[model samples]
Target: SIEIGENEESAMCIGVAILDDLSYPIAAISLSAPEQRQSDELIESAGIALMAAGRKISEQMATG
Candidate 1:
């Protein structure tokens, strides 16, 4: 299990990774903020995006 966030002053992204027993990431989320938008609000917004990403990946893997 891992969570990573990147803030480049102007832009930011939040990421989360769920690893398998073998330490391979089974699912992951990567969210990007709007241009020149780096703040607590942006982070909060990214969380929702990341959550959707993670769920989408998990569903794809489950079906495939």
Candidate 2:
């Protein structure tokens, strides 16, 4: 994620492990933001959103 934004002054990234159908960690989910465009509150919001997404993906995999 070093240059994912390419032209940003500063960026933040947060990720969570993604679990397989068997509940094993098989991948990951990452959320990124450009510091100049995001406030600390926004970054926190994105972190929560990222976690929620990971949980939803796990739930879907478990159901399917």
Cα misplacement distance, residue 63 of candidate 2 (Å): 2.1
* Candidate 2 segments whose C-alpha is farther than 4 A from its true place: 1-9
Stretch of 10 with least lDDT, candidate 1: 1-10
- Supply the TM-score for candidate 2: 0.69
Off by over 4 Å in 1: 1-13, 18-27, 31-37
Best by TM-score: 2
| Cα deviation of 54, candidate 1, in Å | 0.8
The local distance difference test score of each candidate is: 0.60, 0.73
- Model 1 C-alpha lDDT per residue in residues 1-64, reported as the tens digit of each score: 2123334544555677755545478666666556454666766766777667776666666566
Candidate 2 per-residue lDDT, tens place, 4-60, comes to 345544766678777877789878888766667777687778778888898898888
Error of 1 at 22 (Å): 13
Error of 1 at 35 (Å): 12
